[model samples]
Target: MDFSDTIGVSAAGMNAQSTRLRIAAENLANKDTTATTHGGDPYRRKTVTFKEELNRQTGVSSVKVKEIGQDQTPFEQRYDPAHPAADAKGYVKMPNVNSMVEIMDTHEAQHSYEANLNTMQITRSMLTRTINLMK
Candidate 1:
């Protein structure tokens, strides 16, 4: 692949990682959200799925977000009798989001984004050097 193609692929990767970061942030933001009604489901953790997409013209495969699906993991129950959404047994269903997991996901996504950005920058620099050499 050429320098442009390398940059394009890196950009696509960055975009996918950006989406992942956003979803992780969203999950973290809603980590404490509880169900409005008793016995109702609270905010489920969001997950990001990536798929390989091919650019027909460039014959390049890049990553794309397949879906932002909800995690099917069961919510944890907490004893919060005074809470408004507490059930009859004084148990409240908490969100499935785990803060530690979300933080880890965020860090991973950030690293992936930085990697792609670095690839793009290096490719750009190489292209620039090639042009300067020809002058």
Candidate 2:
């Protein structure tokens, strides 16, 4: 692959990772968010799905975000009798988000983003050196 293809692939990867990081951040921020209505469903964790796409003209493959979907995991129940969202049984539906899992996801996405950024930078540097040599 040429320099542009390498850079394009890295850019696609970075975009995917950034979306993952954003979703993780959203999940973490809504971790404590409970439903305003009694017995209503709480915030569901969001998930990111990726797919590979090929640029027919460039003959390059890159990553793309397939979808941002809700997690199927059931919400947790917490007993908070005085809370506004508490049901008749005195249990409130809690968000499915786990702080530890969100933190780990954030860490992984950050590393992946950095790796893609590094790849792009390296490709650019190589391109620059080639130009300088040709001159």
Candidate 3:
């Protein structure tokens, strides 16, 4: 494939991974957040979905962030009577965010972004060398 195609594909990958990282970060940041008002639900974990697309101009395959959605799992209940968001039964709703899972997802997104960056860099170098050779 040509350098332009490499750049286009890598750019798409980077964009998708960047969105993944953002969602993961949001989940991590709100892990401890409980319901603000009485008898309300706590923060739910957010998820990112990706899709593939064809770059018509470059004729390269690329990825895109398809959607951001909430986790369907039920909120965890903690027996904390004194909490502000506690229900009548003295139970508080806890955020569904899992720290370990979020951390792992963050790492994966970062690595994918890095890989795309590396590909773009390598393609740039190769293209530069080809141009120099032809001069």
Candidate 4:
């Protein structure tokens, strides 16, 4: 495989991780959000699924986002009688997003992004050195 293929693969990985990080951030931001109306569903945690794609021109395989789906976990019930979103039982349905889980996922995504960036940088350096040696 060519050095350019490595770069392309790493770039694709970075893009996928970037999307995952974005979704994680969104989940974290909406963690405390409750439904606007009583007995309504609250925010559901979003998840990103990745799929592999083949580049016919370069014959290199890369990753892409397959879908952004909602988490199937049940919402948490929080006692907030004064809140407008609370049901008759004085319980509000909180978002299923868990802060610790989101934080860990964000960290993992960051590590993956950094690794892909490092791969791209190393590939570029190798290409540069090759050109310099040829010159």
TM-score of each: 0.96, 0.97, 0.95, 0.95
Better of 1 and 3 by lDDT: 1
| TM-score of model number 1 | 0.96
Q: Please estimate how well model 4 matches the true structure, expressed as its whole-model Cα lDDT.
A: 0.94
Per residue, candidate 1 scores C-alpha lDDT tens digits across 1-135 of 899899989999999999999999999999989988877888899999999999999899999999999999999999999888899999999999989999999999999999999999999999999999999
In angstroms, how far off is 125's CA in candidate 3? 0.4
Local distance difference test, candidate 1 = 0.93
Of 2 and 3, the candidate ranking higher by TM-score: 2
The CA lDDT of each predicted structure is: 0.93, 0.95, 0.91, 0.94
Better of 1 and 4 by lDDT: 4
Q: How far is candidate 2 from the true structure (C-alpha RMSD, Å)?
A: 0.7
Off by over 4 Å in 1: none
Supply candidate 4's per-residue lDDT for 32. Answer: 86
Clash number for each model? 0, 0, 0, 0
Name the best candidate (by TM-score): 2
**What lDDT tens digits, residue by residue, belong to model 3 across residues 30-92?**
998998889888899999998888867656778988899999888889999988888899999
What range of 10 consecutive residues in model 3 has the weakest lDDT sum?
53-62
